[model samples]
Target: MNGILNVLKPPGMTSFDVVAYLRGILKMKKIGHTGTLDPGAAGVLPICTGKATKAIEYLTDKDKVYRAELLLGVSTDTQDAYGKVINTLEVKASHDEIERAIKSFEGSYSQLPPMYSAIKMNGKKLYELARSGIEVERTPRDVKIHFIDILNITGNRIVFDVGCSKGTYIRTLCSDIGDRLGCGGHMAFLVRMKAGSFDLENALTLEEIKEMAREGTFEKMLTGIDVVFKDYDRISLNEKDKNRFLNGGFVGLSEGKFTPAQKIRVYDHDGAFLALGETVSDRNGKLNLKVDKLFI
Candidate 1:
């Protein structure tokens, strides 16, 4: 019952909504999503259940890829098309111009989270303040943009793909791209493609999950917690060493195996996950592993 699930969340349900639904379906009291996707967004949302919830922080650092469509000449107060229209403009940019604008957004850049976002402002969520007709100065945040490529540009609609770090707002990205084109824009739709190793292709929708549960095959939908730990370095521990490592001690390493001062994953003799450990060497040139977080 403790594992990870890649749920393909549909639009109109908050990230928490998905968690609640899965918690009820699986009858598991503990469940959580690795990252939050807006209620208006749809994507590969990774849910951790039972003991797997302890590894949520490791999954959050994974890169995310998105497919977004922007509608030119219209801007909404919420930045996405899910909100009321607060301003309108005339479209003038051609398809080529729009493509160029999207290219300019590629690579590292900072963005200011929109007022309608869920970002916290003075212990209160910004969206709550936005709904109350209150406005506050929101400083821009440093977000990484791996790349931006135009997928399709037909008429006033521009579809593009973006790979970025966590906390990136695709809505603001579209807004910034539109500003460079001088035609203004608002995101019409967004579909996340990848979050860590999980992708839309391998995701199970809400309907699919329920179907599987009814068929007594729901366990197949849940993945092992180690799947989410693929990004970390793996270490195989022998029985003699496993006992030592479990007691908060480090094991010796061979030359050219792994560099010192690295966070590594320790596995039991049977290849079961033990816990996360950090490796360090003493001034006397002796290597030791320190238990950072132990599970077994």
Candidate 2:
């Protein structure tokens, strides 16, 4: 049970709810989820179990892709369709104008996080303050919009696919596009298509997981913790070195020169995964592997 599960989170349930549901199914207490998907959006959500919980940070840092629809001419308090309407305007932008506005957001940019989001402000979650009808000034944050491809457009609704870096807010992106066109807008619908290497095509629904559990095939859906660091180089330690590494001592690397500060996956002589280590210099100016994470 020490692996990741690409769970297909259904709309209307918060991300934590999905983790809680899996906890009951697997009867494991060490379960956790990576990214937080909106309760109104449905798609791939990687759930970590057992030792896999240690990889949540790395998993959440990955880029995510989404299929979202924006409704032009209306703006909401929350920047999404679920929020209360704050203003409305005539749709004056043409199809070409809309397309151009959408393309203008490609690449790097800065954006203001919505107050209805989970971002914290002075130790209080923005949404918490918003719930109490309180508003505060928020500084803009740097976010990257890799690309936004228009899928279809009908009347005042535009559907598209977007690839963005972590911490990007698609709702704010839609609102910004509307502002560019002089007609306000809000996110009409959203569906996460991919998160890092995990895609919707490979995600399993909660019902499917329960069924697999009953049929004794649920184990097949779990992914190893090593999968998160597959891109990193690996190093094996001998009996003595393995003992030292596990005890928080640096292990010497006799291999070819590696890039400075490169992270390397570690394994015991028996081929069992042990820990994640980073190459660092000791006070004596010698390069060695410093333990970053220990699974043993």
Candidate 3:
């Protein structure tokens, strides 16, 4: 229960709902999800349990991929099909035009976040304000759309596979595409295909998780805590340095070149993962390690 669970979040359940469900099933209090997904969207949700909760920030910041269906010719207040229709326009753009419009957004740009979102402003969640019929001026945020591939286009419905940075909103992306095509649109459907290194292909559904729990084999699905830092370099400390690191003391490195402020995984002489450490310059300009997080 001290690792990450690649849970397949079903549509119609809020992200918090999924965490609560797992909490009840595992009867563990220290469980949390890496990021929030829209209630109407289904996809890979990495749920961290026990000490793995400490790595939530790292996991949430990873790039994500989604398959989104955009319904043209209509606009909604929430930028999704579940919201009330606010306007309608005839979709006259040809297939080539639609493809070009979608491809034009494949780089860095500022995007306005939808009102019906979890963004906080002045200590209140934006969704809460939207629910109260309050509209506030929101500044556009800078996000990178690594790529947007046209998966399919049928009539006025356009399906695309999007690879984007951490804060890109697919709903807003669809609305922008519709506006570019001269026909307003909304996100009709969305499914998250990947989150960082986790993909939907290996995720376990809630029912499957329950069955595994009943059979007492659920632990097999748990990924180790180090999985989150697989990209970082590893350093194994000797007995003396391990004791020093365990007690929150800086360990001086006598060899090996490391960039200042670079983070790396740390282990003990016995090959036990210990903590995450950042390389820093000491007062005398010598390289030293500062503990960022201790797993043990």
Please report the candidate that would top lDDT against the real structure: 3
Residue 27 in candidate 3, Cα distance off native in Å: 0.7
Q: What's the lDDT for residue 82 in model 3?
A: 89
Q: What digit string (tens of lDDT, one per residue) describes model 2 on residues 98-212?
A: 9999999999999998999898879999999999999999999898999899999999999999999999988899999999999999999899999888899999999999999
Residue lDDT tens for model 1, 226-246:
777677788888899999888
**Superposed model 2: Cα runs more than 4 Å off:** none
Report every candidate's CA lDDT. Answer: 0.86, 0.91, 0.92
> Which 10 consecutive residues of model 3 have the lowest summed lDDT?
253-262
Candidate 3 lDDT, 1-296, residue by residue in tens: 78899999999999999999988888889999999999999999999998899989999999999999999999999999889999999999998999999999999989999999999999999999998999999999999999998989999998999999998899999999999999999999899999999999999999999899889888899998887888998899999988888898999876566778889899888887788899989888889998999887
What's the candidate order when arranged by decreasing lDDT?
3, 2, 1
**Higher-lDDT candidate among 1 and 3?**
3
Flag the better candidate by lDDT, 1 or 2: 2
TM-score of each: 0.95, 0.95, 0.97
Best model number under TM-score: 3
Candidate 2 TM-score, true structure as reference: 0.95
